[model samples]
Target: MGKLPAADWTRREGLRQLTAALGAENLRWVGGAVRDTLLALPVKDIDGATPLLPDAVMERCRQAGIRIVPTGLEHGTLTAVLPEGPVEITSLRRDVATDGRRATVAFATKWQEDASRRDFTINALYAHPETLEISDYFGGLEDLDARRVRFIGDPHERIREDHLRILRYYRFQSRFGADLDEAAEEACAALAHTLKGLSRERIAMELLNLLGLPDPSATIARMRERGVLQVILPEAQACHVEALKRLIAAESTSGIAPNAIRRLAALLPPAPEVADSVAARLRLSRTQRGQLNCAASRVAQDAQNPRALAYTEGMDGAIDRLLLQGAELSALDGWQVPEFPLRGGTIVGRGVIAGPQVAAIMRAVERCWVAEGFPGPDRIEALLEEQLVQVLRDPSA
Candidate 1:
């Protein structure tokens, strides 16, 4: 709501040195810092736009004895690691060519030209790092204050420049603003099919960010409504409006936010192969993949019986998985089940073989213990020994 206070003298000096070394003028702060200053959010990354070429910027940084990295030189980006933090410096550029996955850009001298190529107006604002004077070329400051996210030009054409904007729209909507614009929504729906052309890694990253939002189910439902989710995660397509509404209601009642794996697991229907394929396609990390698999497995097995929960998912595992499911079902008031008390060593000590027989006996003992209200170690050991003796009496019994 208020203009950002003037840049600190120290930062100004650094910028001045950078500009003097490069023989350039009008180096301005841009992107997230400018957007957040208006929103009063804590800014993390400081980005600047300048008319100097990438090579010239690097040369200037080097002359000043500053650490510089050509992170994306071809795309006109340079990273200068100042003592305060890393500042990203990018030359003004227009898209020379694009295939949605990558772009060829040519340097430009006008800030508006650079802003026009950006995805949204709210992000196109800039500020003089030294004086902290704000610049709104496309009414970005007004849009930022209004909390609206509008594409700089034609939505469909912008999306064609990079299909990732489709996901970025939802992310920004969830993070910074409220109320989706009908025209933006309609454009997203019409261009939904183009999302399939995006790289799997890019899609996965966007989906992960979306799911990490505080109230992701609504955004996900919007994606589904627009047929975008169908392209990236068709397995979850069956979870339409009603299912999402129920999930959101349940989440509101539970008062606990579900993590990405739990959220993704809840979105899936009762289909093993579909879950497996989705996990594989998304290239989920091993831990995420395992959690999703466990959640889906618990959901499929109808893990209602205490004995089954103890034997299959164990105590801690059962509690975690059940809590996630409870959040999805809005059944947080259910009674808590005790964990399994028996260990494999308890069965092995009873002269049970160390192979599948030991595992089988331990599982059975644990099941019994869970069903019997999780008896103490003494009782569990006695019950386990009794089962082991009976099993030893007949190998095939």
Candidate 2:
């Protein structure tokens, strides 16, 4: 209800030009930016809503010589490219129909109708671009002030409109809500089975975002208690809440930001094969899948050979495993993983036969080296000779 700290980009020439062309009076800043600002949090993306339809918004941008992207034109959204970043300006809209997964919406001239259709009250708040005076028709400001994230209308009807709202509810609660709303929780639980109707990518994204919060352990535990977690991730039973508490504290003490895959990995069953199944079920990206599987695979090996784990899985994967196991993050400070010193040439130089024998001897020596904490290259020649001699004597050895 008062002036918010303005981002420098809001005053940039490109945004000013776009705002002037669109008629500043017709544009009402909306969504996350307004909610974040009102909560005294840093704003990232800026969004605005207008009564003008998509065509008029596009025409105004064209007239101003601004680049307009019809990012979601059918849904009445256009992104105006600015020097600072893209600001999405969507026309006011109301849901015409929804089937618990997708919505058919129609453009509207009334802000109240637009606000009424949003999933949560906190997300429905809007503000004046210049004055920063909030526009809250749905008690969003009151809910935000109380840190209570609630559905805009009836919880059951809202979830019925979009099953994805169940995940969205948990995501919002992880970040903004002090505690779960019992009605919203019951509605989400009752409709948890409908999560199967949503796409894997959408579910994966919301889960990742929820886990990426500063401390999502409690929120995730609650989701598990409410039977929502099992519906979305049937393979995942418990979140290892105690381990996750230590992991979160380690991240804070070490100034490491929360990582989604690592947090997800912490909650999963501690087996590489189980991680693989979970990744495939959630349709995680290749990199995320690899990191999670690598961490899971190395959890047991980390105790005796953290340096080797770091070498095999990379430093991040190794660290994630270590932290999740309640190890002090200081263990990784100044860690320089020593590389295996022997190569094929080194094996060949020892008079070992060139074919598979050389490869076999090299691998054996590397294993010994890893076991020995990767001693200096100066000592590798001796170790290689010892291994090669044993191989030659046994042949099958």
Candidate 3:
């Protein structure tokens, strides 16, 4: 057993009232909230499990004048929106059947059964909200202290229940697991093919989170060894691992927050068509697809001045393109990119009639300004004048 958090869990009035309404003994804080609290980590989404079914929980919430949303009701879960925050409550359950994607669960009254059906030991622990007492049926606290991510019961059986657990397993390992548990790793490698059965949306989300983890190089290396990476991202090359490593190092040294799509670009083959194929395969978001395509398209083109690239594209896009080119990270050190000073109106003011010519002259002058390292406003005006003289001299120049 593990000691509960030093901070009193019952201090919040809503939690106190909700506990009384649902019957404190019948409900205990469960899953990530409890796990995070015990580990002294930042807790989000205070979730709990109850012996009472979903409808009963809803009825109790209504009677208590608490706002209730029947979210995940089919899975025996509901949301109780309180002033402090929304707390997700679910009925204790056991898997009735599963199809490697969704599970049909039967509500259970025993805590042990609920704990047994979960994916990993660290996620199965429970804590009494009022008593601040801890419960451990699967030795989750020990695994948490050890930072070992072990699947509950048999790894193969757990993964067979939901193939998405294969990805989830790696995610947890990257964030929490001190080192890959041998049994879990072997099972994931053996069942890597099952990942294809999962939905593209789920695969995309899991991969994004995995890539966002600080220094996921080791986990990704293991994923490649287990053939998991090929199943999800066949377009990726093993040699790109070095590029990913450099990106991670750059991010750490520069204090830049993690960008999953940027890191994904580093792992992928540097080709625009490859990005298109991957974007389609993963069903990436419109914004994500655009970023991937832009980074891939610029891979072959050298960005001599990252500040100029940053001005043209956003800072994140510039960093992604530069990292792909293996450019010096120091180029991003005092990032200051001035906007091009020559707009259509500025060109029209130069006595050039505002029409296709104005637009063309603006484009031509802007190109020259960028090529000249984006000079100050006065210099930009001089360049614009020079382009105007050339255009007037030959109208076709």
Candidate 4:
């Protein structure tokens, strides 16, 4: 792991002084900040651990004139909004009970006490707030350097403590570009069936985070291979796995654009009901829900059309759908759809009544104009007046 930069050292010193004011020992940085500092990845939120209780931390912050928010007071977490960003300061705590969803934890006075409750060994590393010294109670430094994702203790026990950890393991591994530890993978596989007990929202959040990875298709395929995908997203059980692999690999190799919706669309099964159900279960945003609907509809509509590329799916939507189609079929390069030159107002002004007939005339003119390669607005307007005159003269025609 690289040494903490000078600026990080400054922040660490500030936190240490805050801890000193609270009379708390062992106040240190923990979790992602430490892991990312080692990997040289950008660290956004810095999480700290301290023997001080949440109230005590708040008292210290108040003394320092720092803004404090009781973000997770019940969970022993306090947030101090610094100029750069909010720092999350959590009191050392160990889980007393868990139902795979929420945990009951008690504040502890020892750093190891808190470290023991963490999900993975790598996440258990801590850096002293003042000295910028790393303290690894669980061989976290070694596991991190080895690029191995391993649970702190018995995988089953850790998983049972929180089933979400099963999904988190894969998500973290994908993000860090680390290989899965064999024992951890086996343990995850063994408890894969228990994933059904987790809430759909929890599963959805993890999947979204997983998709946000640089190359999530392969990790997703691995999840499918382990049956974890089946348990969480049965709609995708029969997804074209090999096709997805090739699509992602090609995108990486051929410099093709990468997008999630396209990849998801490619993996969608043939069953509409299953697709809709999955979307609903995941509680997708209205826009995402609409995009999925459009992707599915377009895939079916353009199934046999060579000119499918000409169809109007929104640009973002098209990219998503095409990626999902995999590399086997090429997506038609998108082109802007022609706008209608005449409106109902224009048609009514041509002595046509302001009724359904006006709308009908506008539609007819627009369709013909688009079909005729969308000539200039002047030509389209002249053609529309002529067509309207002919239509009014011959009702039957």
Candidate 5:
């Protein structure tokens, strides 16, 4: 019986346009939008559920001159791009069959059947587009008020339908639940093996989403205890929990925002090969894999100056290493890595000779420049001369 978002929801000019196009009564706000609104949380995605078929909804929008994309027509979803935002309106559906990765769904004639198909109770609440009345078919409102995350029907059955829900269960539990739903946890734990069937991309995305949460240490530890983490990411063993916890605390103390990739690195064993292997298995992007490799290696922390490490790697990579090492980060404040004023051509022009010797001399001078705390061009010029003399005196030395 909870009231949905009224003022803010009304302000969405896009939703208003969709209301005019789709009829106020035909579409209702559903899923995370309603749940977050009831909890006084910010709603980024405003989706709706309707009993109308996909073609019918598409025709209505076309007649109303609204832009609609059949984002997933086969699954009964159409996206209406409004001035306020893109609202997804999907026909109410019931699961016909599921294979733990995806579901074969059929349009449902009743909201009850659609609500029954949702994974969790908190996500099943629907709000009238005009009246803003909440409809909870499965005690969703009560569970939401109690700060609980529970599966709609049977936990095992729900996990069996989509194995990715196993990770989502922990994520929502951390974000909204006061205590773990015992039945849901046991079901997820028992079906943890099924998670292997999910696409690597989906698993990586879910794990990153969980790591993206502020201080998901306890939930991650719970996942570890339930054997879920080992099933998905065995690289992160029991001992790495404390490592991740330390990194989270260090990030807070250092005034750096939580970063999912760096946090993922914290749970690793500080080996580039391991990070490379894991990143490949998870199908992370090349840049993300490179960053993970850099963080897993101890080369960055071996430098005495943070700026030195920043110069060698990058600001992001240096910060990752500092947070992982739990070291003071004040030295990097208001700091910009200075451009190496002396280019290779500049080195060659300075009588170092154009060859591998020039490159080696350039490297030596660059090291000296960095060691000298990234001095200005004048110092670089002097260092260039100093290295030239040294290299000239001992071409072998």
Candidate 6:
């Protein structure tokens, strides 16, 4: 990590345009972009640190015929909107103060001061735009090489500055570390109660992002043992960890990608009401809540017939059930569950005296069709005819 990876990311037109706007000597790549570059991972986000003030940044970008937004002018951050994507360039800043949720900051010209204000050492690495020289402020290079995700100064102080960092620490560790930082883990556990002050959205975001990582089975088990998981999700128990691990193994075996909310459901007791309560507490989106409910209430029919399950519970829910149950998912790959071939109008056209009876007949036929392995539309018509005759013969039945 002496220099940034020998990649074309630096040669990107947007970055070149940005470098030309802010003198190459004045701009340095910062944050995750710099960190991931050192690790040779694909850099998706491009952020930079500059000694120039926000007004200067805006004027420079404008004079260069570049589009820049005053995204966080108060914090001296401006986003250079480029063709590749928006790159955030922030004036060197030192935190004025923080109260675990928000921070007040003032601009400064020192890079070390800005790096000191960041959460973790690995994230504070900086890279020169032209020379690709990494400015190691907090031994980030060493930490990066060691696969460590340690807090910058004091882990406790960092967590106190933003209680969300407690979760963030674990999230970063899960993503980047090979082993746990015991002292940092203890700090997070000690101050886990402070997480209550943070917004549910923030908690949900971090928790889900952690759960959605490549495979967070070990990290999750660590969180559970450290008491951090219980602080955030009281519903989770020892068994849920095992369930999540099983789900991970199943996901790998079936070649299905991981879904964060689905993993959250695995942590929860398999009950719809419990899932509902957790979703409500976390202020999850309607789609997320629905998935949680569907997962909690597992379908009795096994994944042996995935189409029927997919038909009733939807593709997302069906895949969730299959993964949780550790069932084969080859049937779901590139398989778009088709709509029920029968329709209410089709039943009504058969002279069955349309009403609730039409819907009833349609559902009965649909169930038979599903039971018979989601046969073709032609088969559904025959099933519909037989059901219509049987219902018409015995209206009470």
Measured by TM-score, the strongest candidate is 5
Q: For residues 176-295, write the lDDT of model 6, one tens digit per residue.
A: 998667889889989989988989999999999999999998988988887888888999999999999999888888777889998998999888999999999899999999989999
What TM value does model 6 have?
A: 0.95
Query: Worst 10-residue stretch by lDDT in candidate 4?
Result: 302-311
In lDDT terms, how accurate is model 5? 0.88
Ranking by lDDT: 5, 6, 3, 2, 4, 1
Candidate 2, residues 1-397: lDDT per residue as tens digits? 5445575645668767877889977788888987887777887998989999999999999999989999999898999998778999999999999998899999898888999999999988877666766778888888887899999889999999999999999999989998658899999999999999999999999999998989988888888888998887766666465566667888888788899898887777688999998899889889999999977775554756667777777788878888777665565679887666667876777677788988878887788777777788777877877887798789877
Per-residue CA lDDT of model 1 for 1-397, tens digit only, reads 2356543432546666665665545587788887876776777788889988887787777878988988988788888876667778999999999998788999999988999999988898877655567777787777776777888878888888999999998888778766567767788888888888888878888888877777767778778878888888887765433454565556566565646666676677645566677889988888777777776675634445534464456544454456545523222235454556567776677666678988878767766776676678789878877786789798765
Highest lDDT, which number? 5
Candidate 1 residue pairs that clash:
none
lDDT per residue for candidate 5 within 1-397, as digits (tens), equals: 7777675865677777788877877888899989988888888888999999988898888898888999999899989988877889999999999999888999998988999999899999988887898888899999998999999999999999999999999989988999668999999999999998999999999999989998899999999999999999998987788889999999988878988999899889999999999999999999999999989985544547888988998898888988888877888999988887677888777666688888787788899988888888888888888888888899875
Instruction: Name the Cα RMSD for model 5.
Output: 1.5
lDDT, candidate 6, residue 390? 90
- Quote the lDDT for 129 in model 4: 61
Which segments of candidate 1 are over 4 A away from where they belong?
Answer: 5-26, 300-359, 395-397
TM-score to native of every candidate shown: 0.83, 0.93, 0.95, 0.87, 0.96, 0.95
Q: For each candidate in the order shown, give its overall lDDT on alpha carbons.
A: 0.73, 0.83, 0.86, 0.73, 0.88, 0.87
Model 3, position 84: C-alpha lDDT score: 91
Candidates, ranked, TM-score: 5, 3, 6, 2, 4, 1
lDDT value, residue 244 of candidate 2: 68
* Candidate 4 collision pairs: 262-320, 262-324, 266-324
Model 5 residue pairs with clashes: none
Model 6's lDDT to the true fold? 0.87
